[model samples]
Target: MASRSKLNQICQFCRCTPRTELKKCHKCGSVSYCSHACQREDLTNHQRACRVAREGVIIPPLDFLKTRKEKERLTEILTHCVPRLLTALYNDLARWMEAKSSALLERCINDLKLRYTPSACETHVLRVVVSRDEMWPSSTSTPGELFTVTKFQVMDVQYARESMVLWKDCMRELEIQRREAKANGLGMIAVVGIECPALATVRLLQFTGVGRYLLVTPAESGQRSHRRARR
Candidate 1:
């Protein structure tokens, strides 16, 4: 049993059990890494949890939104797209953070402001919708009419301070649904990437354990949560 458990065990960052000893984080004691390199590699994802745990802050797990079947469907759709989605987010951030020209900075800020509109939850999320062209037209299709239900996966883009209200409002709405979030064809899954643009810093938020639940659609409200993607 001991050997079997070890075989199944993996590092929190690299997800591989190296030949070297695995070390549990001294502060949080919840994460284990196979090496210093692995720990450093995971710092972007683990920083918030480590600090919260060390400071004794208790964060409630965001409520689950979908039934097992629906969740499985959401997972199936997202499984293939997460990498590209994350890369897009990183690229978007890099373009902003590394901008040296006023024109470029202004353009990035305006674009991001539109993307992160506080009133539109969908705007805050980086989305991947199934291509309508790839979708076969139904009998009722008009020349330019769009489909009512779109298949998509969205990841939240978070900033600091004032955005906390937006995060809470999103949570309250989802919580009222009692965990039965709606599902369209593919349903939604939560992925979050945090940035403090003022500070020019970004952390790749990786949801682990129950921390995965946050903003979702109404048939979808519930799952991966929104928080201060702080500096």
Candidate 2:
């Protein structure tokens, strides 16, 4: 194994880090970044290498091709392809499962970070919500289209057993989601909650005498180019 000193002196892209906490690219284990900004700058190129040299290949399911809309396509890729790919790379993920609509889950998390600027306090429950627009493909879309929109309300916290193996299983899964670091470390199972589709903007909703939620409005662009930015 590379020593701590060795890790500190190497930079995967610029290769100028004489001594720093090597910011390892969570994907391909071979590359390390010197800083968060450095990693962000190298991400485009890193993904190419990661895809080619990473531990496993992810060929999307055949049904994915049949999905017409980009959102549906993305949904298929995240829900079907990603999990399968992670399972291939980490044997532990093969036995773990979390029921969620991929797009909504991602949208909610993005909305929280990009729009709401989440507080450091973890004691309060954060709600996620997404609404469908008239333009969005839905079950009522002309009778012959793929509309897979499901709403979810994921809690910021959820129940999970405590163990390195179990924590690892969750960590690997989150890493595959590209939201890996959110778990901070395998010290605890961090990403479990009420999975749901949320609004794009940060807003509050009153349900009864007193209740509110953070909504991620401005539905998905489906371009894949504007993926959630790193914090």
Candidate 3:
């Protein structure tokens, strides 16, 4: 057994002595981190090992997640499309979308503005709903007791373009709300959804204890998660 003085107590990420006790990796049990933040910062690298070891199935590296190349069309929408929509919320494009869908985008932006930083509201406020069925991804589509019984149809965007128009309107509307909010208090931002292949990485193996759940869809995988996703 190693002597107490000779024990390996260094943090894996910063390589500095942890202010508090270092926490061991729950999955691998071979590494330690100072905090969840350090573990998160090193996750991209860690996942390369952890995912495969945890899940027996080999996963290809995600190209989109790797390249993350700028979408030209998305940039085009920010530059030109949004302002046009703001001029008339009930214009031709709005006519194409269901009223509830448009309102949902606007409402989410408004709610986020209450929490998001001013700078984040300006930049991150423009978000697109990637999840199907609803903007917020849910695990089981089956109605829970908490699910509201409403007569209205839940809107899902079939094409990225369908969400884009409302996203644009919501983006511009947030700006307007921001200006008006300075006179009151609330201000913040999401409305940029784009079309890209839904590529993902596989990280499971029977040898490793990682694949606690199957990564079938965004709802089943990481989209709705908070802590698991931060890793």
TM-score of 1: 0.23
Residue 209 lDDT in candidate 3: 14
Predicted candidate 1 versus true structure: per-residue lDDT over 1-231, tens digit per residue: 559668646899878877777888887887889888888899877876886788865433223645778756655555556556545444444443233222222222233343244223322443222123323324454422322213322434343223544344443443333234323322332223233332233332211221112222323221211221121
lDDT of 3 at 197: 17
Per-residue accuracy of model 3 over 14-40 as CA lDDT, tens digit each: 877755778888986767888899999
Worst 10 residues of 3 by lDDT: 201-210
Cα lDDT, model 3, residue 172: 47
lDDT tens readout by residue for model 2, 1-231 = 989777666776677865546766776677777788878887866665686568566434344455468657786777698667544422211111222333433444453442354341132223433233332223333321222233444333222213332233443444354334334542211132321132112222211111022233445434332563221
Scored against the true structure, residue 113 in model 2 reaches a CA lDDT of 47
**Runs off by more than 4 Å, candidate 1:** 1-4, 58-231
Q: Which candidate number maximizes lDDT?
A: 1
Q: Model 3: how far is 29 from its true place, Å?
A: 2.8
Q: What is the TM-score (0 to 1) of candidate 2? A: 0.22
Against the true structure, what is each candidate's TM-score?
Answer: 0.23, 0.22, 0.23
**lDDT, model 3:** 0.42
